[model samples]
Target: MAIFTIDDVEKTFKSGDVSEKILKGVDLALNEGEITALVGPSGSGKSTILTIAAGLQKATGGQVLFEGKDMTQMSQEEIRKIRSSEFGFVFQSSHLVPFLTVEDQLLLMLDVAETKLNKKQQKQEVSKVLDLVGMSHRKDAYPSSLSGGEKQRVAIARAIIHQPKMLFADEPTASLDSKRSKEVMEIIRNLTKTLKITTLMVTHDEEMLPYADRIVMMKDGLIE
Candidate 1:
């Protein structure tokens, strides 16, 4: 079933006298436990739609429904709560805290998500997620000491540590080479499927498209 829906969504940017419409009546659905990839040329609004659905940005018009809740109608606090607790995100950059170890990073996410697990339970959860991303051994390593791929793996582990209901990934493998990119994609697919987390990703890599369960193409701000 569709846990998330975008209905006639529109986004526009205005600069003084100039106005540009980025998304024109976009309608899409993200189903339960599936990965959906949004693909389009630059400026086609794929990333805009992803952020809108993720609650990182607002739609100029129409509804962004999460589990049937109209997010566009929600207050900022309400939207922020959902984004922090129920959603996960992975970006092109690992974006890890330079000072934190792999395990500490996951712990920080739990703190941010307001997870109710005790310290021991949180540590166990961190270990499990690290193992999921094949980063268990590097749990004590800081970001600076890790390779690019390892850092990204740690980022993935941190993203899912709180067991978020939805995952939003934007060009998650763009910083890696072909081998590392494939590895990262496989980890993302396997983790989301195994944990039954719904995912929406915006990616330009054709090689990564095969990992997504559905591919939605966009042109001129509309799904094609």
Candidate 2:
């Protein structure tokens, strides 16, 4: 089955007596282990689509199915559980905790409820993911000490650390130089492939399209 299916989804908002339609019956799917890029100009609702898929926002109409279950029907607590166990996220900003080391940032994503790992095993898992993102050398470093590229890598590591089935990334390369952006994209693509994690990224940079297996173009909230 497809990892995600957004079937005729729509979102609307109100602005003090003014009603605005953002996403207008958009349909899309994310398959396992592939990189899908959502590209568009400003105000096309690309971020809105990501937010809805991530369950951060509810669609006004239609269904969002993750792993064949309807997202619209789940309770708030159930949704939170699904978000924690079934999905991961990476944003343009690293959004790392100011007080946590890079390693701790990743550990925070692991399965804490059913975890059988001791401190040593947990450290090993952290080491494995840090190595995957090529951030092992800086595992002990705080977010303030890392470069933009390194910080993004750590964010990616944290997202995938728990082996979530899907990942949503919004403008992940927005802050980096061209070279660093390409490197970060390559790392994301490679790791997604290796882990068989379905990844959807929102971006406006045409240079990064080549890294995506599929590109979904949005215009005025409709997929073009």
Candidate 3:
């Protein structure tokens, strides 16, 4: 079933009487428990649609429906509430805090999501997520001490620790080498399957397309 739907989405940026249209009537849908890969060259607006669907940005024209509720109609505070509780994100960079331990990172995500877990339960959840990402041994290590793959693992752990219904990944493996990229993609696929999390991923790497259940190609600001 379709869990999220984008209907004729359009985005325009205006500066000094000049307007650029990034998205021109793009439409797509993301199914439940499936990974949808958005692929395109630069300037194709792949990332723009991803961010708009994820509520990180707004569409100038369209209906973004999540679970049948129109996100485009929601206020900033309402959208923020949904983002904190229902959506998880992975970016090109791990974006981990340099000072926080690996376990502490997941714990912080739980807090930000307002998961309502007690202190002890929160710790246990952290341990479980770390194990899932194969970072259990590095739970006490800070980001600076970890390798690139390890940091991305922790970032994935932190993302899913809140049990979000949707995962938005933007060039998640762009910073890693081929081996590490495949490893990270495998982890993301496995976790998304096991947890039944619907994922919308934007990636330019052709090598990673096989990992996604569906591939959407974009060109000239439209699905092609």
* Candidate 1, pairs of clashing residues: none
Tell me how candidate 1 scores on lDDT.
Answer: 0.94
Q: Rate the local accuracy (lDDT) of all candidates.
A: 0.94, 0.91, 0.95
Lowest summed lDDT window (length 10), candidate 1: 154-163
- Candidate 3 C-alpha error for residue 92, in Å: 0.1
- Candidate 3's displacement at residue 200, Å, is 0.4
TM-score, candidate 1, is: 0.98
TM-score of each: 0.98, 0.96, 0.98
At residue 144, candidate 3 shows an lDDT of: 94
Best of the two (2, 3) by TM-score: 3
Ranking by lDDT: 3, 1, 2
Global CA lDDT computed for model 2: 0.91
Write down the worst ten-residue block by lDDT for model 3: 150-159
* Candidate 3 lDDT (Cα, 0 to 1): 0.95
For candidate 3, write residues 184-211 as lDDT tens digits: 9999999999999999999999999999
What tens-digit string does per-residue lDDT give for candidate 2 at 127-176?
A: 99899889999989999999999999999998888788999999999999
Better of 1 and 2 by lDDT: 1
